[model samples]
Target chain A: MSDLQARGHEDWLDDVAVYALGAMPMQDAQRVRAHIAACEICRREYALLQPAVGALAESAEAFTPGNGPIVASPELKARIMRTVRPERPGAATVPQTDAPVRRSVAPRERPILWPVYLVAAACLAIALISSISDIMLSGQLKQSQAELAQLRSRTNALASALADRQAAISDVLAAGAKHYPVDNGEVVRSGSRLYIAMYDLAAPPRGHVYQAWTLPKGSKTMAPSLTFVPDAHGVAFVSLPAGAPETSAVAVSLEPEGGSKQPTTKPLIVVPLD
Target chain B: MTEDAVVLMERVRKRDADAFEALYDAYHRLAYGLAMRMLGDASTAEDVTQAVFVKVWSSPELFRTGNFGAWIARVTRNRALDVIRSRTVRAETDLPQALPESESVEDTAFARIDRELVRSALASLPDEQRRPIEMGFFEGVTHQEIARRTSTPLGTVKTRIRSGLRKLRAQLEMTVTT
Candidate 1:
């Protein structure tokens, strides 16, 4: 029997309830998540328990007249309406009732004229066709412009990457170049520029990236540098800002995507430059 | 006759202003109440409520399935949690990333029941059972934190929450059938 099966069904049931409530700690949650993925019994139990947890939100006492004095003011509704209907000026400024108040416009009576009706129909058709053509053309134009902008962005990124690669190569070859070996990587400093050259480093876990940090000399805290993912070969060359002259040490840690303001995990590699 | 929320949502996807207004009117109280309960401040609650509704208005597609009321409440709770996180260094809880699917007939029936009934059902639970669930649900605290606050063992707190939820589910199912 698998470890999950050995642990027994009743044992996992306790975790299913807490996991459904979203109250489990990250480590415990991960274990429960893995078990739930493998165990059909636990999955059903989780699904069964979810609605009850969801129903708990309804237990909150909403504000009503005589319930309390903490009612949501009309202004709050007005603000929401304004944001949703910005195109229609003053249309939603007034708070609405439970039912949306619709304005009904009455049709006026007029004498029937066959020729006038025919002429009007023809004019409407012509106008509609012209408007549709214009709209189609406008849409295509916008698409083209967007494509152009995207291409320009890609080119600029490529140019920047090429420049950095060239600079890194020059840094390594330049006189007075200093290198400090780290775990599967090294920190290279030439003049004021610093670069982290990593090789054979495994990809960070999903939803995570390798972030570099610099601890400036005499500073207790490490300032954030940049976040990067290695290429297909598990190789990365990242350039740090020109703060290496006064920097005491550099460190890299696996952080969530978009990076964290501070190190949230232990450093995979730390290089002391000072 | 009152329109179904799904029908109103379809109209909302087409930018039917009246339908949008009706949806807002129907669920605003729930959203505001949830935010207030979690946040404990009237002005901030109103802000959170407005943000939640505006999200529904702009991206109704984010709510793919499940009870609309339940989905909105989850959104409001998550927003309130974000506000709380901004203010303190509380350990973050992992709320579900995807929208919940309405899985069974019982889930649908429970969704249709009155909110007041759910409230009363919760109120009927013993304090030991109910308090931990509330602390975990509203406060977004971990089970460990709940244990710490109540001075109970971690295992006991988990058991009480599990027992309470099971009982709550039974009561709601009974109410729906009757």
Candidate 2:
């Protein structure tokens, strides 16, 4: 190694880590940024370690419904949808700018006629009434259309959710299905699909969730699976994302939101398939 | 699942409301959760969460490619950082850039592992190592500030951070491989 490389390993390596984390003070970080830009060894090390630092953001526990220090309210989603929905193409109304401009008649250019004024006033009254009636009908029509659209969206969502639940239920009852019972749940394997069905699960502590981990065959470390929150009825049925044939064991634990790479708490459930 | 997300994003680009909602339902927790952790207020967290998702809807094109979860997480963090900056008087320093566009095999593997795994890996670290790292990243404090809060020498803080990150990388690699 060159002298610069050797010295960097001794002097600047630690700074690279701090820099990667973006926790170095401004002046110190600037100096380190300059050095790493030139030093191949330190630069490579920074690149290697940066993802790990990025992964640190994932370490924060996420908010899960019913089991949270805080729940992300549904109103928040409504607020977001409210903001973006109007921005959708063809969703907003364009103001009419094509109405003809009327020129005022000069008293000298047009002879004053009382009967004509009276007729014009009558015409104006009829036009105003017609415009108001049209506006009221248009408003009702828009409101009805909006309600219908919302109903359609809800129906589609419900249909989709029902279909998914039905599929999971069918998989559980399929021939050759194997079931392993745990503390509050059962692991079901049907063909290549695996699922965890839990009942009467207490809500996780504030800012915590129940996360699953899979031990793939011949693997010592359990790979993290999905994080879930039981419904209001205290039930959850989650399909394992990976195939069951390759997984040897399944475990679940109460973890902070976002879950842990490893189980932080004792596994509440562990089932061995083989 | 990643492929599914890519497809969903394509739909989002097409102005599909259902597709956007699906993405939101899948990821809002991660976005809001990160915001809550950083901001420590439910109301502000909700606001930040809304802001992040709105940005996603407004500019799905900003995310050309890469891990959606990671990209969203970074966006949430950056948004929270702005709020945190507005709340404090600290000197502004540039945050680190997002993960490199062309990921190495290891980076791709790391991205494939979900947030829960990464959180578990962080949980596995010793408190001394984990605390400094958390303070630096989540709290957006500098090494000197971490040293002050944790009552360690600045040099020791830097060393601990390095040691902690290396250990974290090793743990994640093991998790990914296994």
Candidate 3:
């Protein structure tokens, strides 16, 4: 890399750490590691950096929820399956996966639809409440009630349909179905590769649009990998910003709130990375 | 892992009836356990756990693979996180109330030492650095959430967390070496 005693010492330590953590860019990382082999001070510094990274990982390995019991419903699965099934099938199939239970419940892999729905509900309520006063209510109530009765019948039919779903789900779960695990190597899986950054988003070449992107690791680079108009999840899962690794780093930038060639502001958060 | 429950997931993707039920039975307990871990309250865990699996059914395609157990775990975890996030918990903070039952004494002791040391080092950080780091890593506060709670500039919040990690590493390194 450089003569062992030659490089300036001030920036040298940061280099050692960047190397140790593998946080440095590839070429620079090679240079730092090469120097570490000969330089005792850097070597010692590298040793120190090791557990610090682990402790950070341990802390980051959640960094929340602590070492506590994850509360769960005794009959939640039945409830979920009930919600989906149209009719219960007579036959049950078996689910098999290479990984076991430990890989099953790591936190981030779960569907966010529940909370997202809750958020949507709150938003809907806000939207409805704001607009409710404008509704003309004279004879509408009576008419609405008639419709409500029909809806309830429909709901009942749906319930029966759902009940069949429940039975099928019950047959499938049957008290120990294997879970499908999405391992993002962290408690959260922000998915990888181009997801939301699809170019099909480039349509309607007209109005002022919004934008999105996969960001640089550790909030560095000040550039994004891809950009798009996100769906409700605020997901613009682009080709995982090329060199991005699974570390708690990333921030989403808002660009014209529709679409932009580059990041218009700093970012919303160190996304998917966080 | 061919529990009758596992089969439902296969059907679940293609919109099967019986397979979903079988899958539900197989991994329901673990999902509950995970909810318990994230949420702590039995009731809250229960609510979130049910919601997790239910969501699985409606949007089965979102679940990209056959790893139903892990998928459930991931889903369970996400549900628990949301429940914890939106609901303001009034916890009677019990710092290190007891040694976890499953851990051996030696492992626990070493863990405790590391935890304490980490805590001490964290405490030494400037408030700016400590807040984001603790919130992000310790409290699981997402970067957006931290910025919102603190009312700090967004970029500044990021810098503080990044710099905070650098400093935290530096200090912890010093302590162990000394």
Q: Between which residue pairs do clashes occur in model 2?
A: A62-A257, A69-A207, A258-B116, A260-B119, A260-B120, A261-B117, A261-B120, A261-B121
Instruction: Estimate TM-scores for all models.
Output: 0.55, 0.53, 0.32
Docking class of 1: acceptable
Report the Cα lDDT for candidate 2: 0.76
Candidate 2 residue runs with Cα over 4 Å from true position: A1-5, A26-37, A63-70, A87-274, B92-106, B112-116
The parts of candidate 1 lying over 4 Å away from their true place are A1-8, A63-70, A89-274, B1-3, B92-106
Give the least accurate 10-residue stretch of model 3 chain A, judged by summed lDDT: A179-188
lDDT, candidate 2, B1-178, per-residue tens: 4556678989999988888899898878777877888888889989989988998888787565546766677788778877877888766543332222222212444664677788788888899999998888778688888887889998889889999999999999998888
Interface RMSD, per-candidate values to 1 decimal: 8.0, 8.5, 14.9
User: What residue pairs clash in candidate 1, if any at all?
Assistant: none
- lDDT (Cα, 0-100) at B174 in candidate 3: 77
Interface RMSD of candidate 3, in Å, is 14.9
Query: Which candidate's TM-score is highest?
Result: 1
The best-first sequence of candidates by DockQ reads 1, 2, 3
Tell me the TM-score for chain B of model 3: 0.47
